[model samples]
Target: METNHINQSPIDLESLISGLKTEDARNLKLMLNIQSMMWGIAAVYVFISALKFIMTTSWYDKLGGFLTLVAFVAFALLFRSYYKEYKTIDYGIPTIEMLKKAAIRYELFQWRGLYVLAPLLLEGIGLNLMMFDDFTNLEPLNRILFFQISYFFVMVIAFLVGYIIWKKRQKPLRDYALALLKEFQS
Candidate 1:
């Protein structure tokens, strides 16, 4: 890139450092808030499911609520684990080396974050497996139709979320990191 007669001078080191720190702090707060909200939502679902399990007359709703309650609690645990970890990341220093190290560590954290989603994936599969009885009680045609329709919706939503994260989040983050860290790479 040409350096001469740019519209504006490059950002000062202090400004860059402060900007990065602010960004990290803001990101952490947002993450923690989201996790807390997820936990809250899961807890609410668990309560609702418990009420349904106790008060409902249908075998289907009872079993379904109990199973869903388990899944929501599992999700709450996942969020709690990551929330604790997010709470621990501190602003260390404003130096370039420290920032570079922080960036690398953040990348590792992102990978480790996959563990946070494992419970959801496992529960999703488990729910399907355990749902045989849920289907068996219903009429054959309705069972097959409903199951297929639910799975179709789930798969479409999964695909859309995956595509969105890859395109809007992952790619942009990778590009931003490469550009931002280029100066410190020696």
Candidate 2:
């Protein structure tokens, strides 16, 4: 009878305290860790390529490579900060505090995103400058259609992928955190 009464209770204490036990939170941590490692590897590769470009005889290559390095370094640092934020999640913290952290962490767009635009613009400009020599021999129209149009398509694809990831993964985790917070408050 006691067991049956307990089962009929309105709230389950176990469910409330299991912060990281939720599937969404666990998945979020795993995804962040994996992405952080992958971005670190990509940063290293870009560093090597940038060095090669800077070592070339072409003046354009040198300038473009320097710009690209600056932009990519910013991206790498941003990704590292995200990784560090997730790493700081401590189970021992108060549940409300932990949930608040998770909510902020999963936000799809934050002020930092605005700051990223400068680096993104720099990268685009740098890439175009780097390709100047290659595109020089092509007809002007062909160069625009081939290089510029293709770059636009690549950016679009990347944006769509990022949106999908946020919607499918990050948004749900955020929603979950909010829901848990609401439950706690009531």
**Model number with the top TM-score:** 2
The whole-model C-alpha lDDT of candidate 1 against the native structure comes to: 0.65
Over 114-140, each residue of candidate 1 has an lDDT whose tens digit, in order, gives: 764655555554455446466677875
Q: Which pairs of residues clash in candidate 1, taking residues 3 or more apart in a chain or in different chains?
A: none
Give, for candidate 1, the lowest lDDT window spanning 10 residues: 1-10
TM-score of 1: 0.49
Which digits, one per residue and each the tens of the lDDT, describe model 2 over residues 1-186? 987887788988567658537866887787777777767766786777677765788876777777877887777777667667766679899999989988987898888778778888778777776787897889856864676677778888998999999999999999999999999999
**Residue 114 CA displacement from its true place in model 1, Å:** 11
Question: What TM value does model 2 have?
Answer: 0.63
Misplaced by over 4 Å in model 2 are: 1-58, 138-146
